[model samples]
Target: MTVEGFDGRLDRYLSEVLSKTRSFVQKIIEEGNVWVNQTQVLKPAYKVRSGDIIRIVIPEPKQLSLVAQDIDIEVVYEDEHLAVINKPRGMVVHPGAGNFENTLVNALLHKFSGKLSSINGVIRPGIVHRLDKDTSGLLIVAKTDEAHIKLSEALKSHQIKRIYYAICEGVLKEDSGVVDAPIGRHPVNRLKMAVIPNGKQAVTYFEVLERYDKYTFVKLRLKTGRTHQIRVHMSYIGYPLLGDSTYGRSKNEFGIQGQVLHAGEIKFVHPITSDVLHFSTELPEYFLEILNILRSRNSKYHV
Candidate 1:
């Protein structure tokens, strides 16, 4: 990519282009992965000029000798090439800050160790996509490098379809709508995401499924996936997800843990065989419980 528009420090410029955090870009630059005009620059604050050719190297993640625990997980579909797993709430997708064990990666390692793909490194072998630790849903895992690459490209191109079900804090005035917004780190709260002008493109289409006295159940389709996208957008539009402590109300009104969101459906073409594959999952017990309570209250229903 050619540098244009704005000129600033090398790391700052790359962070905007890649839609990544400055610290993350700085780490890569420090590791000698970025070159300006074919000359490597180790300092993050190195000045960059407009029209200067910039090349970046995104090396594959290195394995960190992840552990394989005897944790149990549900595999919805599996072939020699890939597998789809239903991740339960509260389980981290992989190793991350302050979490190293008892994650979905550890469980996958226990069951399919040698057979999983290494594109995401040993820390997250076989993992292709992610669901937040509090979000219960379906995820894909690649078994080979080829499958990993193809699936990743498919996700990047938005060829894969992902659908989610969530319960938010109020009735949606419109029957359906779309939230097209740009999301970036919050200016005041660094730990949270906000709709910023310079943030990456994000879109979400939502249809009202049911409406209760104080809450609404909706089906959401992701047009472009970004970190905390659905949660951030919904909150931005004044319909924050119930139990969403990060973006919504922190009060435990419904006695539920974490946000009441779930990835209920996914569809995509098979990477190797070119076959179209679709998968759906039942909403977890927590979601069902709330819906049931709402149903008993004589709430309005829609398709």
Candidate 2:
């Protein structure tokens, strides 16, 4: 297909045509998928002249048994700049570790018809932020470079607000408090994050929304985005999230998969228009069920 754009640079044009990152687009060009005026263009920095015919032959991305399953996703907002999706429990955000296929990325590829921002590369197209495989709720995606840059800046500056709902294993003695600590990979166990003296600074504010005899439902706001910040902080303070296997509590009576946490809400300014954008997703059924059980048990015990 021939696209006509005036005075646009070659890299930008290729990125748009391939719906991928500059790196991926360059890789495609290197692999000989882009043709300019019937000749293959090798250089990403090649400037284009007016009335130039740019032909982009996008090869099918290497198949990896990653079928684009039509998994149902709740979309809160979508535009040219970004999109908000309500991810469900038991869904892996991206392919990693032993999960090579059947991930949110695979579903997105099938749903979006491979038209995703490639800034994060092929395996993680359009991914701006991420959630744990079992931690359900809202996530954001960037559709373009402008959107990606803006969102990344917002995240780095802590302007983008992310609020989560977590049911912890024990009742907090205080009504609310802050967990200000430094987080880093455990010196001995690389798989786990720890609050160490020389670690990166991390902060979290929490308020107890409901208190059960054996659990506490709290709303947590992250001041910094670190891997497992919420989980690590809560565990550090002596109340690990319910069903969290890695931290303090190793068992759950509720029989829930993974942790009982949700990325319930997100707020940020639009990258292109500077409009304030807010999105929220309700707790999944499993979460509500646990809450109901706790509430029911608490009521009877209190009486």
Candidate 3:
């Protein structure tokens, strides 16, 4: 693409403009697929001036060899156009990185028998949105490309409602609050996200459901969906979610594997029927067990 008002490194501009990962842009650059002003620019750090005509040639995606595995998944609702599933904690949404099997996609592949939308490519066949591996929640999967596009448009317009429940590390003084912050990849830790000044806009509205001496149960609603938005925003406000090793304390007495965040409810308009659909799931057993423990301790302390 031709450079316009941006004056930065070629790779950074491409990553931001195309919404592709930095690594992917770098790979393409190294492969000599990017040209600036009709000249091949292999270096990722090549500075580009305004009005520089940049061209990129993206290669076709390779045929994925992912296999369907027969794994159990909780299907809350299903129809010809879409499926709403209550994904359990510890199950990756789709195959990626080191996790290539036993994921939600694998299960869906088996259940649907390969009858899923291919809009997101083979690896993430029907997935429209994602939750963290440790985040148990409701997810909508599109059965066809038309439904996928409609659902995607709904998400873009902020019409879909996503609500989450989380256990925070500290008692929030306010009963309700909003965290308006920008989130981006951490400058130091690549695996984690952080609140950066130049990051994408992220807003999270939270209400304190219950408060203890050192903990708070909060309900969160997302105004904008960004990667790790809740975790980054809560940590930025000094009320990190309990058991969030990347953003909060690494060790906790609750014996939780990851952060105690659950996508409790989702409401959206059905793509095909044009009817409002809502789905909710109860908290996972492990989360409830921890809550019970906290309640008992809280009562004892008050007594």
Query: In lDDT terms, how accurate is model 2?
Result: 0.82
lDDT of 2 by residue, 26-106 (tens): 776777777888888888877776678878777765544456777777778888778888998889888886776778888
TM-score of 3: 0.80
For TM-score, candidate 2 versus 3, the one ahead is: 3
Residue-level lDDT of model 3, residues 161-197, one tens digit each, is 9999999998898989999988888999898888889
lDDT of 1 by residue, 4-103 (tens): 9777899989877775546567888999999999999899999998899999997776755777888989999999999999999999999987888999
Candidate 2 lDDT trough over 10 residues, lowest sum? 58-67
Query: What's the TM for model 2?
Result: 0.77
For all candidates, what are the clash counts? 0, 1, 0
lDDT of each: 0.88, 0.82, 0.88
Cα-lDDT of candidate 3: 0.88
| Clash pairs (backbone) in predicted model 3 | none
Better of 1 and 3 by TM-score: 1
In candidate 2, the residue pairs with backbone N, CA or C atoms under 3 Å apart (3 or more residues apart, or in different chains) clash, namely 21-118
lDDT of 2 at 43: 86
RMSD of each: 5.8, 7.5, 5.7
